[model samples]
Target: MQAVDVQDYARRLMEAHGDKAVAEAAQKARALEEKGKHEDAQPWRRIEAALKEMLGPHQS
Candidate 1:
């Protein structure tokens, strides 16, 4: 088997167990964006996006 990048593995693990975190981060991202604090919301948005991707297209 190929060696897994540790950081990537950890990220995947977080994504696997991330439903609540994803929801909260997404909510925060939306709120910040609405407030014109897009820059501040960038990381949260990225996190929400990545975790949602991990959850796949079937997720609600």
Candidate 2:
């Protein structure tokens, strides 16, 4: 995913899931990966990374 899309999705997810947004994004990525959907999981992985960055090292 593009950086802008990742940030946008991460922001929306954070708003929806609050503190659990990272976990939610991770779960989505893992689920797709486990199902042999690596391509599909890429965006979620990006979002997960973006969410982690947004949270910062001191947060999560």
lDDT of each: 0.66, 0.93
Candidate 1 local lDDT, 1-60, one digit each (tens): 112343354376475656575677678889999999999887676776666666678835
Model 1 CA deviation exceeding 4 Å by range: 1-18
Expressed as tens digits, the lDDT of each residue in 1-60 for candidate 2 is 688988998999999999999999999999999999999999999899899899889834
Q: Identify the runs in model 2 with alpha carbons over 4 angstroms from their true place.
A: none
Count of clashing pairs, candidate 1: 0
* TM-score of every model versus the real structure: 0.57, 0.91
* Inter-residue clash pairs, candidate 1: none
Report model 1's TM-score to 2 decimal places: 0.57
